[model samples]
Target: MNEQEKVKFFEEFNNGLHRLGRITLIAASLLLIAVPFMIGILNDVSPSGTGFLSGFAKVGIIYIPVAIVEFLVYAPMLGVGGSYLSFLTGNVTNMKIPCAMNARDIAETEVGTPENEIISTISVATSAIVTTLVIVVGVILLVPLQPVLQNEALLPAFNNVVPALFGALGLKYFAKSPKIACIPLLLMALLCIFVPAAINQTSLLLLPSGGLALAIGYVLFTKDKL
Candidate 1:
């Protein structure tokens, strides 16, 4: 074949591969909605108002605020979750969140337009949903295999995926204001390392201890004499 024919042939091949990739992606996306429902039926998961999924749904359905409160109370430091995933995978794709610490900070970063905001949200949510779906699908896929334990293998991968994504989102935020960012973060790490044990006896105590530590640190830092 001539050079032009060779180039044309390769271009067509590339287009075919791209089309196949899109088809697979679409199938995977559709499975996200279906798989969870299938799992519910197969497992006979119900509105027990208890157990993991049910209890979460019950709490969410009755009192949406509580879920928000819980998330806020237990939220981790900047990108640490993503960083953990990066550690696990030894891959930078773990840092795929692309969300900054908050909207205000994100707005100040390079991606500071309405279009960018949309992109940022899409990027972060895509990473999160993909990570979550991977775990669910992994567990489901392994169910028939019985003893090989593919689900166990998935846990570390998903765990690493979380922090890696978070880290990626906060990368720009980290660069913009390093010192301002590190204060609460350092305190959180210290508490995570030292106080989880003391708070383990009581779920409510954990929140208060963390809140107190954060409040104390803020106050100390704000004080002129300190």
Candidate 2:
């Protein structure tokens, strides 16, 4: 086929993907909401409307901004299908993002390219499937593995899982461009060290860290230092 025909085919595929993604997301959300209400009805227990609103407001006030920021930050790298799948599967930061990044790196695909988009989508979908299977297995094994999981010797490892994951993932990028990463890394480190509370506010802290990185990158770019 000609280049034009290929382009048209890809566009059509993307359109269909987006449509399917939207419909699935909506259906999943409705099912999530309906399940709880259905259970409540079956149990003949009514939840307090006032308490529900109050609880939702409390959670929303914190999560709404974070969700918006995450969408903006992750969407471009994830592409349309990956973004939709990641958001729907709900582990963008810890699982999907890492999976997608690793896939791109392994595939030697650049972000924003068609190859990267397809790789990212496949990576995220695989991650979701693997995660679900792991969860199911974990649940089935929970009672049997209680002693192993609850072992004091493994506590430290469990606690450090996130840090270890990110550290390993980040080391390569930091090595590649220490100039762009060092300042933000140092600044955040200092903030976390001094404030301590900043560690708990990592989601909120991404804004300043990201902006600082962007500004530094821009300056370096203009100066031809990158």
Candidate 3:
């Protein structure tokens, strides 16, 4: 196919994928919300609607901002197909995103390109399948593995998994674009050092840190200093 034909084909395929993804997500969300209510009704002990709403609001208030920030920050890197699968599968930060990044690195495709989209989708799909299998296996083995998992010595290692994963990923990108990385790195370091409490709300902090990096990069490019 020629360039225009190829572009049209990709657009049509992406739109179809999006339609299916949206319908699946809607159905899944409805079932998740309905099942609990259905059980409560069957048990003849329906929860107070007000109480349920209040509880949902409390949790949603905390996470809504984080979810929005993550979407904006990750969508470009993930593209349409990968974003749909990754969001559906969960574990975006620690698993799917890392898997997609490694795939992109291996494929040598820039983010937002068609090649990157394909690589990201394949990477995230593989990660999601593996993650699901691991979860199923873990659940099946839970009783047998409880003691080992609950071991005091292993607790520390478990807690550091996220930090270690991000540290290694961040180092690679930092080396590639140290100038662009510098401001955000320093900002995050200062936030961690002075307002250690902010660590818990890392998603909220991503806006300013990422924005600074983007703004600096733009300015440097305009000034021919990059």
Alpha-carbon lDDT, every model = 0.51, 0.89, 0.86
**lDDT of model number 1:** 0.51
- Candidate ordering by lDDT (highest first): 2, 3, 1
Number of the top lDDT candidate:
2
| Predicted structure 2, TM vs. truth | 0.64
Residue-level lDDT of model 2, residues 91-182, one tens digit each, is: 89988998899999999998666678889989999999999999999899798988998999999999999999889979988998899999
Residues 8-108 of candidate 1: C-alpha lDDT, one tens digit per residue: 77567546645764676567668866887788799997434345675555445435665455345422321223322322222233244334334325555
Off by over 4 Å in 1: 1-110, 145-200, 224-226
Residue 120's lDDT in candidate 2: 91
* Model 3 local distance difference test score: 0.86
Q: Tens-digit lDDT track for model 3 on 1-226?
A: 8888878888998999799889988998899889988999999988888977866766576678779999999888788888998888898998888889998999999766677788998999899999899989989989788899889999899999999998999999889888899988988999889998998877667667867888989998999987
Model 3 residue runs over 4 Å out of place are: 41-44, 143-226
